[model samples]
Target: MLDLVAVLLALGLLMYLAYRGVTLLILAPAMALLAALLTGGLPILGAYTQIFMTNTGAFIVSFFPLFMLGAIFGKLMDDTGSAKSLAGSVSAWLGPERAIVSVVLCCAVLTYGGVSAFVVAFAIIPVAAALFRAADIPKRLMPGALALGAFTFTMSALPGSPAIQNAIPMPFLGTTAFAAPGLGIITGLVMLLLGLAWLNRRAARARAAGEGYGAHADGVPGPDVAMREHAQGEGFDIAELSGDPAPGKPHRDGNLPPVALAVLPVVVVIVTNFAFIRIVIPMLDTAWLAEPLFGATTIESVRGVWAVIVALFFAILLLIAGNWRRLADLRASLDKGADASVLPIFNTASLVGFGAVIAALPVFDLISETVLGVGGGNPLMSVAVSVSVLSAMTGSASGGMSIALDSLGPTFVDLAHATGVSLDAMHRVTAVASGALDALPHNGAVITLLTVCKITHREAYGDIFIVACAIPMLALAVLIVLTNLLGSF
Candidate 1:
């Protein structure tokens, strides 16, 4: 039908425009209006103002705290030299021979502790650059190293990860961050090991080709050269690189905070988050949450969100307390973090609005029905494929996951129940799938990583595609097979 054609066209337009570097702020609403107008009976302005804004506003309301707090926490880490100090210690401990693993672990630790991926890239890149240069690793491999750590296991498959990808599925599937604990642990390890192997292999081949960290084609010094220049007070500054001048200059080991002190805040986040989810929130008598004003919510619906928020709050205070004397301007850092959150939240919310409008069209009903019917009654594969395709289309994990679950979550839940599937399995699978295709060339995270590392897609995207996308997809398939055979865990 023409309605279906219009829906397809809108999706195609969204992907194309986004890939061409158009901001989603414009493309989401424009593509949404196109879909609405082509459907032939809706008031275009009403759809934009009413349906679109409502869904967008709802997403922002639900997640603003996490976004804002996480950004602020990451900014504090960057500003205080905590992030760089941790990176430096890890690099020294791992030695130049194990540079790839060192970089990957640094990124994994930060992200698993709830730092935003965008912020992780910015915070870690200079360190990654320095390590790769020291190890004589190809500069092009930096993105892969960073992506492997930040974009893989810790971001999606790890149980108790504070990543938004993991959090988004909690309310929808009525599951917790620790959903499918056995499966998540297994998948996380698989991704970590396999992705590391791939990157190491690539590094070996690049070494065989005698390719060292090449000079930046744009005249920026390679990491080693830059560090040498800094030694002579003529190089790119760390303060400038991180956009915070608190850590005025690189310090000798004696001048830096102790490694344990540098790492304590991250540990606090993970530990506090776990305690809240496993103990604190459950013990509280929150019967009042069932009131109408609270939408008659259950503990399962809000436990994960509450845990992460409290954990972030605790971590923020800890980070500040640990680095108070080193801070440049506390107010400026807070303002910068708060300001930084606006674009990402709005970008995703815009897509949510676009999806809301698309869902209002009659054609979306047909589309949802078709997607829900995939895999011949296996809701696992059905949800996987549906979520993957939509994520690829939206070029955003959070955005695509929000749209798919908002429109089809109930249907997927019903299908899982009918098929005797565990909601935990569904939640885990949906969360992992969202991260898979969502790493396509156009993905916001991928773009940001590439931009931060200053590498072209031609040089770095292949490795990212393999480690972040292809490998995650493979892990998803393996998870599906294992769950189907062993029954949900």
Candidate 2:
């Protein structure tokens, strides 16, 4: 039908424009209206205000705290030099002889601690570069290593991760951030191990091929004007978030915090998040949550967000307390971090808005029916395919996940119930699915990473594709099978 054709055209244009560097702030709404106009007989203004803005506003309202606090936490880690310190220590301890593993772990530690992936890429690249050069490893593999650690396991598959990917499913599924902890741990390890195997094998082949960290007149590309624009649109302005000494050069360990002190805040994020999710929130007197004033939502619906917010809050305080003297400009760090969350949250919310408008069209009923029918009524498989396709189309894990959940979340939840699929398992599958295909070449994170490393896609993208895209999808498949067998244990 023409409506379906219009929907596809709008999506294609959105993806093309976004990849071409148009800001989603403008692009998302414009795409929504374009689709609305083509649909015919639809009130375009009502689509924008009633459907689009309503969804966008609701997403922001529910998620802004996590975005703000998470950004602030990553900024504090960067400014206090804790991120650099932690990364440096990990690489040093692992040594360049294990160059790939060391770099991967450095990213994993920082990202698992609630630091943004953009911040992690910037922070770890210096240590990784130094290690790669020293170990005679190929520099082209650096992005893959970073992607494996920061982009794959820690960002999604790990239990209790404060990453927005993991948190996005909570309200929809009535599950916590630590949902399906056992399965999460298993999937995380599968991704880490499988990705490492692939990267290490490539390194061995490169070693045979006589390619050493190849010469580059340009050191690590600074977050130049163009890179900064793309990065800012995605989220935190990494150029502003980045500190002195530039990116490629390693920081002096003497100026950095002791490794123990540097790592504590990250540990605090995980521990406190777990504690709140398991203990604190449940014990609260929250019968009032059912009142209409509170949106008539249950405690389960809000507890996951609350847990992550509180964990990040306490972690931020700990970073400040422990690094007080180290913080050169505390106010500036807080402001920049808070400011960083705004664009990213809005960007993703707009994507959700775009999806909302499209869903309001008659064609969406057909689309949703098809999506829900996938896997022959298997909710896990259905969700995996739905989230993955949307993520690939949008080139954003959070944005795509939000759009998928915004449109089909309730339907999936009902499917889970009827099929006796555990919501916790469904939550884990949804999170993993988002991170799977969002790593395509046009992805903002992928582009910013290649730009920062100064490696062209032609040179390094093959390795990145293996580790970030192919390997994570393999891990997701494994997760689906395990969830089916184990049933959310």
Candidate 3:
């Protein structure tokens, strides 16, 4: 069909652009515009834009405000010595025996707090290197292990995931984090087990296979070269080293408070999602968990926004209650937050925009439509493969999700509605696959960890690819078996 040909050309071009670092944030909506022009011409593009506005409402451009807030909260914590206080407390309790795991856990907590994956990777890799060497775990294990820790919960199923990889589909699918709590929890636990298992297996394989895989990308004799190289950056600033609260005077052990503060945003989003969708929305014409503040936005859009607001609110309260001890430095903290957020905000929006346009094209329609018919029988697998394929094509997990969120999201959901899959199952599987595959190539989280750990795609990424690419395939198979054999209830 001419429609199919036009669609393919657009998708191919979109993929090429995505590979060039244009990002799904920009690529998505832009592609949507292209697809419209190619398929139904300009009129269709106008209609889709109208639909986008209705979906985004007036708050489309403001979505990143929450991310900014979360970043601000993180900046304040670091500036005020809150983060270190929290890290120190936990390190003490964890002991040197489980130091690597402790670092990973700490990083995960911060990720939930809304820090970028790159920031987490850079900050935490050094800690992992120190702790792993301390525990006699060897440097090489740091990259894979750190990657595992950071990617596990955050990638798959964290509530209030600031990543936007998973949440972007919520408005269309009617699947909020609250709707699949049990599934997400189980998925996370399964991934953690798999990650730990891989660690043990890889260590054994390395011992058996000989570390002769060579010094690895960071050019070290061990797996840790990646981590070592990243930490060697331009000496430490005094501000970063000594912002601790008076060096002593009753701290939250430097571990618990920062950890808790960091994790609070995610918890608020996940827990509130269910209540907002199931309990509140049905009662009112429209429900915005953040309605009081932002006036009736969808939870997905508002989740990041509200959590950051809450983080800011709590951050300020903590600062004021702590007697405005760091009040003079507040301006410095704000600037730090803004500086870090610019890249993520710019990239994400552009990437999402591009995907929106491409999906609206005949190429997306033809591919999506064809996949829908094939996947109609085994929806979970269909969704997984599509996301992974797109991710690999784009080199970003979140980017891959953006592609599916536009072209495949509605198609898959409609198929599920028509076929026999439960909405909850579909939602859970979608998030899991998105998080999992995002582990490969362009996944910012995986890339950050690798860059810091000084490992290369050849050495460590193969391991991640195995897990990210393979697990979702396995999950899809299982879902197919369960739904087909056991039947959806």
Candidate 4:
């Protein structure tokens, strides 16, 4: 049908243009209107003003706090030298011989602790570059190592992760960040071990072939225009990093806070997050939540966001207090972190708007029916596939997952209840599924990682695809099978 053709064309153009570096702010709305136009009889302007803008605004309202706090938290960590201290300590303790492991572990800790992957990339690259050179490992593999750690397990499968991917499913499933801990641990371990095996084996092959951190023109550490553009599209303002003493390079250990002091904020993030989810929020008198002015939502709908915000708030305070002497201009750092959160939240919101318009199309029902019709009567499989496909289409795990849950969350909830499926298992599946196929060539995160590492897709994407994409897919499959066999833990 012409409707199907129109939707596919719009999606294809969106993906291609996004991959070519067109900002999604323009592409998302433009492509959305294009689809509306092609679908004839649709109210194009109304779609834009009502459907698109409403969803976009709603997304911003619901998620802006998390984005602002997360960006500020990551910025504070960077400005205070905590991120560098942690990365350096990991590299030093693991030593250069374990360059790949050190880089992966460093990224894992930062991202798991709630630092933006962009911040993790910038923070870890110098340490990774130095280690790769020292260990005689090929520099091209650095992106894969970074991708495996920051992009895979910690971002999605790790229970208690403060990453947006992990947070996004909570409201839809009425689950906590620590959803299905047993299953999450198993899936996270699978991604970590399988990814390490692949990366280490590749490194061994390259070593046998006598390749060592090959020379490059832009090998020096610094964010170029391309990196900034890609980073901004993903919601990280690389301009914020320009204020750093060395900008792109890592700081010396002597100047960094002790590893204990540096890592304590991260500890605070996890501990306080757990405490608020299990103790603080539940103990509050949320009975007033039923009031109409409060959107008449329940505590479960808001608990996850509240926990993350409070945790990040305290963690930010701790970072500033511990590093006051080092944070030269405190106001500037806070201002920049606030500024950085804007673009990323809006960028993702635009994608949500685009998805809103597409979902409004009469044709979207057909699409949803087809998606729901699959999974062999299993709501878990249906939710996973839907989230994964949409994530791949939008090139954003959160964006895609948001759209899927926004539109189909209720339907899936009904199906789960009908089938006696646990909401906790659904939560874990949705979060893990988002991380699977969203790392395509067009993904903002993928482009930013390649740009940051100064490597081409041809050179680094194979391994990145395996670790961030392929292995995560494998982990998702494992999660589904285990959940199906044993039910939620």
TM-score per model over all chains: 0.92, 0.96, 0.72, 0.96
Task: State the lDDT of candidate 1 residue by residue for 17-104, as single tens digits.
Answer: 8877677889999999999998874699899899999999999998888888887887777677777778888888889889999999
Q: Per-residue lDDT tens digits of candidate 2, residues 1-489? A: 888999999999998888888889999999999999998736998998999999999999999999999989988888788998888888778777999999899999999989988888877887788889888888889889988988999999999999999999999888998999999999999999999999899999989998888775434465765467756643444544344343322223346778999999999999999999788886889999999999999988999999999999999999999888777678877897888889889989999999999888888998988887786889999899889999999999998899889999998999899999999999999999999999998888888898888888998999888888898899999999998887897
lDDT of candidate 3 at residue 41, scale 0 to 100: 45
Candidate 2 clashing pairs, residues 3+ apart or interchain: none
lDDT of 4 by residue, 1-489 (tens): 889999999999999998877888999999999999999737988999999999999999988999999999998888788999999999999999999999999999999899999889878887899999899899889999999999999989988998989998887888889999999999999999999999999999999999888776433345665566655543444444343344432333356889999899999999999999998986799988899999898999889888999999999999989888888777877887888888888889998999889888999999899899888789999999999999999899999999899889999999999999999999999999999999998898888888777798999999999998899999999999999899999
* Model 2: lowest-lDDT 10 consecutive positions: 244-253
Candidates arranged by lDDT, highest first: 4, 2, 1, 3
Q: With candidate 2 superimposed using the best TM-score fit, by how many Å does residue 468's alpha carbon deviate from the native?
A: 1.2
TM-score of model number 3:
0.72
Q: How far is candidate 1 from the true structure (C-alpha RMSD, Å)?
A: 4.9
In model 4, the runs with Cα more than 4 Å from the true position are: 217-225, 231-254
Give residue 336's lDDT in candidate 1 (0 to 100): 74
Model 2 has how many clashing residue pairs? 0
